[model samples]
Target: MKGYADRKDLPRFIAVFGCLLAAAILLGYVEMLIPIQIPIQGVKLGLANGAVLLMLYLFDAPSAWLLSILRILLSGFLFSSLMTILYSLAGGIFSLLVMTLLKKLRIFGIPGVSMAGAIAHNIGQLAVAALVLRSVESLLFYLPVLLVSGVVTGLVIGVIVRELLPKLTFLNNGGYQL
Candidate 1:
């Protein structure tokens, strides 16, 4: 690994990473506070995804990935259980990959990418559920509802990111190029 001294912008990079991670975790906590009253076990507002999407757009994939992982770990430790971390890890990785690929392809705007990511995230968690329960048939029955939820939540998150990105002028205007 290169020394921090060799990279003049290492501090800036770390600062962005820290800020985004904090934002992701904080938003995730806020999501927990605002109960959705949904009956399904895995359905979530996914409000934290907005920060992850912003990280992806503002930085490279690797940085975005790190943010996702760190956010999951910290949030898991502070708020939830090991199982939550496992499910989130799976979903977040899947969601990030789908969003990154769609963005790279440039075939879809942020909303399209967000919707795809949302669905992918649910699919990922469903896969984990099937593995844990050893009942594919029962889990398969729950897929559609999760998919629909993912789409709705993902769109909401994407729209939030799109709207917030423009307002963050310091980050967008090259005040910090991380």
Candidate 2:
């Protein structure tokens, strides 16, 4: 119940990890298939993040953290470039840290935590963008727009996880001690 996986739950933990990883990758592919375009590049629905959130809530921070990194690497190799990997790695790390903190605080529900995580993701990505461009001002100009997009997309993913969690009662309760 403490969310750490024990020997008895190790197999289940691995299974959950594998399943979440698959879901994240599949969601990333789905996101790629969707043709939602914004004026600024790199803005996304963050569909894959849903699985990472689920892992965080269902198990523990380390589980979610691992999922986030693996998802980025796999999705990057499967669907994008080295730059894409770097950007995603940055965003994913920032997003997971904030989300884990908020979740630990118990101050916000999934929606609020997710929204904050999304903003963090944008900030992280923008930091990388600034580094790549060697221009902080240019990336700063995109902050407001990126924040707005993060709010919208993060809420979408949050609402979805909220709805989806209830349906997974088996996983939530009886699946494992992990």
Candidate 3:
């Protein structure tokens, strides 16, 4: 694999990364607009993850990590609170790590990778919540529901990424054939 330093189209890479970051932020805002109330707190479609997954597949681990962190920080600052930022940072890191590992393993498709990411994200948030509450009981009660939501959301994001991949002419033009 060629390193970022070895790439000839650095400008193109930067532009693509910027576009992905914008898409993630936009998706985050869109998700916020749709007030889907679940019984559990902090559970949503995670639509922004589509951009993250797309970055992971089209770019590399470092790129994906950077984008995820930026997305979490920016979105949290713009639309949420400090506490939300903490939870989102934790979840985003965990999710990205899991997704990157799964992607590296090459044993699963986009849906499987996305599902694992979603599950890991929930687990990360739950851990933080448990720590804050000084007990896991309340959060534990919501695990099953969160897991199901994760699966469904992950599948949807994965399918969206898969469909979008073919239409990304920039990636193809950059000489990185997906």
Candidate 4:
């Protein structure tokens, strides 16, 4: 398992995590500022996911997972409600798991992984919504819209990552560099 086993790796890990966390928070903030509204009640552009995808490619799975969780928590406190936090946790955790698994399989590029994550995120959030509302009808009603939005948002995030990756000299597959 790849991890922070060496003392020398700690600083790089902290630095990378800090940068990605800040980027994720900033993206989340920017997404909030945008007034575009979808028909769905809980769907947004998912711009912060770009940082998650970038971290996944630049670091190990744990780092990506950590960043995802931190982004959810910090962004939630800063810009969203408690309910939003719950939905975000469910969606973000599910999305990260799917993306990490897809990335490990190495059969898909960033777009594919991101799309899977986005779809999974919607499903996860819908599942929570269903539980909270105690209505299967709500899930049925939102499924199509959420799924479509998820794919579009995921593709956008993936494209951003693809464009940004080549220019990020600090990212090394073997390990992160400061």
Candidate 5:
């Protein structure tokens, strides 16, 4: 069995995770700078989610989960309400779950997998918002918009990952740790 002590790249994992965390935080901040808004309560392009999905492919579920939670918390502290943190958590977990399932099926190529994650992320966030607000209205109205944004962002990020994959040797060897 492969042991952590035997791996020369153990420090590399910590470095990568740290970098991923930084990237997520940066993305969250940049997202706040963008002017796009859904007028409705819980819709977003979720560009930062792209990073999370990419990490999922490079790393393991636990790493992706950690990244998501860290990103949500940091973003909440920086730009949103405590309540927003809950929505972010719901969306991140749901999206991660969707991507994990799709990765297992190997149905859609890498881009497809990313798109799937984005859509699920949107759905999950909307669901949580609806529940918390005690109104199905947002879920009903937000689904189509979120779905559309999810597909578009997913494809964009998918293309990026495809271009990036061949170049990153670390990701190529399943170098990610849980």
Candidate 6:
């Protein structure tokens, strides 16, 4: 069986993880300032997830998990309170799990996998927030809008990754380094 840490891709993993972390922090700040409201609360473009989707297709699960954790940590330190860390971590893990499962099942290829990850990430975060706030009502109104937004935004990010993957030769199967 292939162990998580045993995965041969290292340099590529580091590169992707770093990129994801930077993107997450940048987007986290942007989201904080703009704070898009969908008339429901906690619904907005998690544009940083673009990097997460890219990593999911380029590397393995553990690598993706590492990237997510790094992003949450960095974003927490830079943008908001440590309490926000829980929501971010939960969303990241949930997103990674969904993407990994979809990839295992051979779903809609890399782009589709990325989309699935983004969508799940949003839903997971919203669900956690609803639970924490003790406002089940928010979930009822928010879920559908989130689903639509997730699909659209996820697709855009997925497409971007798909196009960029070809030029990112470092991520090629044999080129990944530690």
- In order of appearance, the predictions have TM-scores of 0.89, 0.91, 0.92, 0.91, 0.85, 0.80
Instruction: Please provide, for model 3 over 63-128, each residue's C-alpha lDDT reduced to its tens digit, 9 standing for 90 to 100.
Output: 889999999999999999999999998999999999999988888888899999999999899889
Q: 1-178 in candidate 1: lDDT tens per residue? A: 1253476667766776788889899999998888656888788988778888887776667777888889999999999999899999999999999988988898987888888998998999899989999999967898989989988998888888777766664563454221
Q: Which candidate achieves the best TM-score against the true structure?
A: 3
lDDT of 2 by residue, 53-162 (tens): 88877778888898899999998998899988999999999999899999989888888888889989999999998998999898979988899999999899998887
Error of 5 at 24 (Å): 1.1
Q: Number of the top candidate by lDDT?
A: 3
**Hey, what RMSD does candidate 4 come out at?**
2.6
Q: Residue 158 deviation, candidate 1, in Å?
A: 0.5
- TM-score: the better of candidates 4 and 5: 4
lDDT of 5: 0.75
Instruction: Give residue 30's error in model 6 in angstroms.
Output: 4.3
Per-residue lDDT of 1-178 in model 5, one digit per residue for the tens? 1243477766776677778788878887887777976575555556677667666777666777878888889878888898878878887888888888888777778789888888888888888878877999767877887888888878888778767765664642655322
* Candidate 4: Cα lDDT at 21: 94
User: After TM-score superposition, what is the CA distance of residue 133 in candidate 2 from its true location, in Å?
Assistant: 0.9
Worst 10 residues of 2 by lDDT: 169-178
- lDDT string, candidate 6, 41-110, tens digits: 5566667776666566666566667777888888787777887888888888898899889977884776
Q: Which stretches of candidate 5 lie over 4 Å from their true place?
A: 1-6, 36-41, 170-178
On lDDT, the stronger of 1 and 5 is: 1
| lDDT (0 to 1) per candidate | 0.83, 0.85, 0.86, 0.85, 0.75, 0.73
Evaluate model 5: give its TM-score.
0.85
Q: Write the per-residue lDDT of candidate 4 for residues 1-178, one digit (tens) a residue.
A: 1656565667777787898899999989998888876656868888889998888888778888889998999999988798899999999999999998998888888888899999999999999999999999999999999898889989888888877887774545354321
